[model samples]
Target: MPALRIEGYVIVSADGRLADADNVMPDELKFEGDKRFFTAALDRADLIVHGRNSQEDQPNAPKRNRMILTRKVGATAPDPDNPKAILWNPSGASFEAACAEAGVRSGTVAIIGGPRVFDMFMDRYDTFWLSQAPRVHLPDGEACFPGVPARSPQEILAAHGLKPGQPQLLDPADGVSVTPWRRVA
Candidate 1:
């Protein structure tokens, strides 16, 4: 089997929330610098994995190969709406199988997510890029990862054997910064 370099990408509020109470990403969480970084990362990935609620809205999205995680499908099924996408159920199919079904042999796999989806890959990510919007706070919102709000995203990552690199300021004006948490070999 070809080894996949799995990477996760997410931006969260200072409180570690990824979305609002209704599972909506607020406008305040969207920063130009983060978006640029996200776009560039996804553009370099051979396969993009995400939950149904998470999607890339770039002009190149339609052409990018994607695997949408969902229980609606028994295993790997071709997405009728998008020729470049596959509906995958991890319970019924392995990640490698899903990648093959998506026609990706071996390359970087970018996992963009909602909380549940992000939780599923806790042990698999080689690097997780976590961006923070320092001034934003969502007390009742969805967490970036499973134990969030209760445990900070940083704490969760550290517990999972991922160490944070020096953070880069993505947008100083908005107090937005990103840290790459890499798995300790």
Candidate 2:
């Protein structure tokens, strides 16, 4: 069995924040460059994992095998149009066993976020494809990866054995930016 690889792709402020006060991501955050990066990453995945909020946010939930971790499993239903999602409660043993059974074989296993879900599996993840945008201040909203006190992206990367791999400064004309990180060792 190949090692399971957990990858995350999120856009953040230059200062390293994920969202604004209303938990709404900035329009500039989702650049075409990032979308291209995400689509390529998804293409190499055998399974995709996401929180309920992420699933709702996705315009076209993928048709590839998906596993959703949620507290309210029974209360919600998977999108009828998306045939690949499998709902699983985010508890202890059940969650682990379900993930194992998902058959995340030789390809990537992506973990799209909702903060809590990312925190739960952060230490276990192998790589983080984060997009750091130019500095932008926000008054409120949820963050990209939660739990740690606000810190510079460099500090966060240092803690996780991650290093910047690719920096695609979105069209200089557009003023957007994104960086990819690979886990070192």
Candidate 3:
């Protein structure tokens, strides 16, 4: 099996939430610095896997080949709404196979997510880029990994065998920082 190198990218509230309880990505928490970092990182990936909800959130998404994970679609099918995207159900199709079907031979597979999507790739992440804005706390927000132990996002990532590296300041003014956690061997 040619294991696909998977990387996770996410920005969370200070309290480790990906979004608010209603699945609303808070506009109040938006940071231009994080937007730039996210766009640049996804631009570098060969394939982007966006969960259904997250896909709906990105209206002006970049032009890139993507595998949209959706339970509504068949095991393997082209995303009718997105010509450049493929609807993939990993239960029947392997990650490598899905990539190949999407014409992705080799490169980093970036998994952009809602909690379920993030949880699905937990054990396989090569590196997970977790960015958080300490100034923004969503009191009744959605967690990065739902139903897991109530730990900081960094702790959850660490529990999955990914060790955090020094965080890079995305915006000192906004108090947002991103840490890259590489999976342990």
Candidate 4:
């Protein structure tokens, strides 16, 4: 079976709440360590999977071969100027199956999110490249990964036969960090 990776950057409260009220990305409010790691993950991904809302949230969302899961058949492509994407309607076996059809059986397929998409595909992911931002407060926005019960990054890695690699400090002045992990199983 091909490995499916879920990669995202999120800001959460010290206790692990995903959002506030305004629905903005927590990037600006991230701890230096978490911010660094998030950038590294983005650098490593070969593909990005996202919902419509996520696409809208990103500043200069990359123009890669993306797999967008959506219900609106007539919805326009988020970035018509970039390469066209393979659309997957919400149905059938799994989005994984759709991805396979789209030729994502190997290499990294990053599931970027808007929460609902993450919940739908969490169990099928082989590894999650998450940036656990240091405790930051968001005045208004949703959680980075909402509805996911509290599971330390360590716990999730252990359950999936993975290990956390050393985390790098991107910029001390900026207070950002980056961590990497690999599946040993």
Best candidate (score: lDDT): 1
Alpha-carbon lDDT of model 4: 0.57
Which of the two candidates, 1 or 2, achieves a greater TM-score against the reference? 1
The residue-by-residue lDDT of candidate 2 on 66-136, one tens digit each, is 88776665533454546677666765335455656565455677877767776666666677776656645
Model 3 clash pairs are: none
> How many steric overlaps are in each model, in order?
0, 4, 0, 16
- Candidate 2 — what's its lDDT? 0.65
Candidate 3 on 19-129: residue-level lDDT in tens? Answer: 887987888667888888888887788889978788523444648889988777557798888798999887878877878999988778889897888988888999999
Alpha-carbon RMSD, each predicted model: 0.8, 3.3, 2.0, 4.5
Evaluate model 1: give its lDDT: 0.93
**Model 3 stretches astray by more than 4 angstroms:** 1-3, 56-62
Between candidates 3 and 4, the lDDT winner: 3
Better of 1 and 3 by lDDT: 1
Against the reference, the lDDT scores of all candidates come to 0.93, 0.65, 0.83, 0.57
In model 1, which regions exceed 4 Å deviation? none
